[model samples]
Every structure is written in C-alpha cells, then in structure tokens.
Target: MILIANGNASRIGIHTSIGDFAATKDGKTYGPLNTDGAFYNMKMLMFDTKSRPIGILVMEIPATSATSEADAARQAEALRKEVSEKIPDLEWLFQHS
Candidate 1:
C-alpha cells in the first residue's frame, strides 16, 4: 500500500492495478500517449473509496532511483521535512511511518 497526500487531503491504497501499462486520473485512463516529460512520469496512482482509480499525486522524489538505501532514506527525510512544513497533517504520518 501507499499513501498519497498534500496540504488538503490524503489517500492510501495500492497505487496501481495495471502495473505501468497505464494510469487512471479523474475517472479517466491515461496511456503512454499522454506522456509529458516529468509530469506523467512522476505521478503515483490515486484511487477513490471504492478502490477505483481517481487520479494521481505527482511524487516529489523518485526514491526508487536512489543510489542506495541510505540515500533513499535521506531523500525521504528531506521530503518529509519539506512536506510537513507545508502540510502539518502529514507530520504524524511521517513520524509513525
């Protein structure tokens, strides 16, 4: 499971249903044809309460590409700090996680 959030709200669930073959947003499915540089590539799948795809949340950092686990942890902490300052609701989430 994954958590997607911002200053306003947050959602948690399996990020995707179809692997990387496609993505869904605002009740619409997007294919590779919708590529727009980092915009499309950075999105994490978001789903509604019924477990249906709703949209996406663009990730701040692609930690998967980090050189090592330590690097990923550092990037995650930095991102948590950056996000918590802007969205206080997520502060606890970061701490508990």
Candidate 2:
C-alpha cells in the first residue's frame, strides 16, 4: 500500500533540499512547487515519534504551470482537488498498512 503525504521541515529541523517549506496541521512538512511549476515526486526523510529516522516519505508536488495569476490559481485549485480526493484512501493505508 502506498501512503501519500507532503514533505516539509518540522519545527525542530529544516530540509536542506528544497525551499519554501512549511509545517502543516497534519504533522507533515510541505515544499512549494518547483519553479517549473510542475509536480515532482520527492523522497523525504521521516522521523518516528521518538525522532529517529524510520524511513523516507515519498510525496507528490503540485502540478502547476503558473505563468500568470489566473493560471496559477487554476492549477492550485486542481492540485487541491486531486490531493483532497486521494487523501482518504491514502490515510487508510497510512493507518492500516
């Protein structure tokens, strides 16, 4: 089972690979879309509850070709929709698998 999640630097640390990261309510870190405005898969380091490196969390970056304000908005909305739809199934895997 594949569990989907966002990659970001948590409060205690920072990810050196990518910029524009932020902490989310889900206890995960998220990075901004690349300058190319394309969704890229990232293998992020994950820590267990004890702060040990358990494994890597692979995440999907948002798909965006933001050339202008409207384009960015549309792509962001599309990405949001996609993430929302997949979250339920992914969450199940995260908890069960």
Candidate 3:
C-alpha cells in the first residue's frame, strides 16, 4: 500500500496502460489506485504485478520521523497477510531500490 524509494528520486509515470498486472490468487485482481487527494500526500513508489508472489504495485511512501524500515516492513507484512488470507495463493514483493 505504501512504499519508499531506497535511492534517488525519479518520477514513475502512471499511464493509461500500465501493462499486465496479474493476481497470484484466483478471482483476485488489482489496479493502480488513486492518490490524488490523499492526506498523506505520498507518491507512486514502485509498480509490482501479481505474475508471482508479488502483486505488482509496490509503492514507496515516506515515513514519519518516528517511522523505521522495520515499520515499513511490518506494513508490507501485514498487507501480505491480508491479501493471502483473502486471495488464497497470492504472492507479493517490495522493491524500493
């Protein structure tokens, strides 16, 4: 849901056709979500697809001063749990670098 880039800045363009994003689990699907009016004011970090365990869109978000990589990792872990629970055989990956 939220990701932070591990390196330099770069704008990841969200186009009309972001290509094929697959879902590891049956009946499970995902798309590029809208961050237009998000209070967090985060940007699109990375785009991951569900061709494997990684569901495709891995967004890197800036964390609060108190936030740590562990926190981000926990968030990612939680997301994995939620998705896998509902999707059955879902896969995901986070690529900040």
Quickly count the clashes in candidate 3.
14
Q: Model 1: per-residue lDDT, tens digit, 9-81?
A: 5444445345432443333322221233222233334443344433443443343355543454455445434
Return whichever of 1 and 3 wins on lDDT. Answer: 1
lDDT of 3 by residue, 1-97 (tens): 2222224345333331233333312423322223552222121122233323433434343454215445554555455455445443323233224
Specify the poorest-scoring 10-residue window by lDDT in model 1. 31-40
Task: Put the candidates in lDDT order, highest first.
Answer: 2, 1, 3
Worst 10 residues of 2 by lDDT: 16-25
TM-score of 2: 0.31
The lDDT leader among the candidates is 2
1-97, model 2: which lDDT tens digit per residue? 1233335324224343322222232434344455675764333344443444443444454464345444444444455544444444332435865
> TM-scores, in order shown?
0.29, 0.31, 0.31
Ranking by TM-score: 3, 2, 1
Which scores greater on lDDT, model 1 or model 2?
A: 2
Please list the residue runs of candidate 2 whose C-alpha ends up more than 4 Å from where it truly belongs after superposition.
1-5, 9-64, 89-94
